[model samples]
Target: MEGFEIRLTSSKKGKGLFATKKYDQGDVILEEDPLVSCQFAWNAAYRYLACDYCMRQMHYPPETTSIMLLVRILAYIQQSSDPSAAIAKVKQFCHRTENEDAELVHKLLGEQFTHQMNTLREMTSHVVSGDEVQEFLTPEGFCTLMALVGTNGQGIGTSPLAMWVNSVLEITMSDDERQQLDLFIDKLYQYVEEESGSFLNTEGSGLFQLQSSCNHSCAPNAESTFPYGNHRVQLKALKPIMPGEEICISYLDECTLQRSRHSRQKELAQNYLFVCWCERCSSQASEPDCTSEEEMSDEDIDADD
Candidate 1:
């Protein structure tokens, strides 16, 4: 949290985060930890040992850590972290059942999907309350969890190794030195790929308190990034944000952002379960609605003739 004194304002979607002080472009607005987080299933399969309770990976610099902090530790951690707190802060997040992700629903309904879910419940039953675990086992509860994560999980992507490589390439170097360094890096990557085939962008997602409160806008003022190369998310202003302006983030990727409003709405509806009324969409409100921008272009050409 920086200059922005916050207001939890209400909207049809739920709540929105507003800034009480202005932020310059590239200024960091906030940094926060997640309530819970997990790496991509495929990423986890890459043999990165992480804490069972917190999801802190082991590949970083040497520090004492144990993956043995199981579901029991989850309950203990939550309880001990606050003790007197009645409701978990994560409960403030939107968890509408209708927002259950399509892919998540398909995966959960799969025959093999419930094996880990069932096993985890069985193993943690003694420590976690039966009622709590039982609710999560139900379809409605499952949907709620999926919806919460789907809607609020701010994506995190950072690689310290990749950053170091970029830093080395940026430094001034003689041609021969640069050539030798490039050759060494090529050989290093060859060895790495031999062991781990096709390493791609590290996709890490987390449920953040402040980030979850920020609403989506097709045109956004702020962005969430993992600059420190970990789960600690830093919200940076994409433009000069005014004192009273509400902070918004883009849910759609670059290609989707360029599409017709109708297409954008479809994407958001499918993924986020809401109609957008952001400024970008509002300006195009009077335009003839079509599925794709190309269709609109065709119609306009016909009209011009």
Candidate 2:
């Protein structure tokens, strides 16, 4: 299903979408279709490029076919109607409706799309199967892929895309695999329950699908806790959300300096296409003011001299 449609706001960083209505904690944000509709990307990436332990893909591939394969997977997943796709059938597409920023986006998307194809393909081939990929691509691998693709400390660009891949791979339909995933999910749900009661509420049970949309922040107003059952993600409002707010969530829990946050955001933007211009991002861009005790002491000493 097409997820909630968001509109771009007027911001220096180009596009941002605000929630049109009040979204309670654990309320659904937009649900996105997978950009790559099959498990080939996940299986291939994990089997080859990523770390078996951490599942990180930090390098690129050399073969054009591998790159094209990944690109084709991503291209096929795009709805024929989505404006972003060059698919002629797409009557409606995202445009720089408000800003000249549209032009920058147009260029950026093209480059990023091309880069994704190349890098994903390259990353796939570089992994020496036994070194990075799991023995069976079991449920743990599945969830790790789920987490990796969703939002790790970096971002959630791959999770939605990977869901489409899982759907194609029939990862959920195989009775054995389904049971494994179910157990894992159940375990996660339990973890959330033990940690915080508010994370998984009565109305939010099946909303694990929405976990793919939660972004990360150093000082987030929202938080997600994983309980032991159902591998569920429980969302909680750390601060009160106003009506029509974007319903922010954190990618990280600890306090980080502005530069550190920017570094992570940059990683997300480079790896995923979207630039996060969240509250932390804006603060990070500005230079810090001079207000040190050392500076004050030096001033006093100079005055005495």
Model 1: ten consecutive residues of lowest lDDT = 61-70
**Highest-scoring model, TM-score:** 1
- Give me the overall lDDT of model 2: 0.38
| Candidate 1 regions with alpha-carbon error over 4 angstroms | 5-10, 47-87, 97-138, 165-200, 291-305
Q: After superposition, how far is residue 33 of candidate 1 from its true place, in Å?
A: 1.4
lDDT for each of the candidates? Answer: 0.64, 0.38
Please provide, for model 1 over 1-305, each residue's C-alpha lDDT reduced to its tens digit, 9 standing for 90 to 100. Answer: 36665465655866788888888899889988766555554444556665543444423211011111223224533455463331355456766644344344434335454564445445545456543345543545544554465566666555555667788999999999999999998987788678766544344566677788788899999998776656778899999999889999898877788888887886787667789999999998887678656867756885684
136 in model 2: Cα distance from truth in Å? 35
TM-score of each: 0.68, 0.35
Candidate 2 worst ten-residue window by lDDT: 200-209
Per residue, candidate 2 scores C-alpha lDDT tens digits across 242-285 of: 65565456543243223354455544544334566667666766
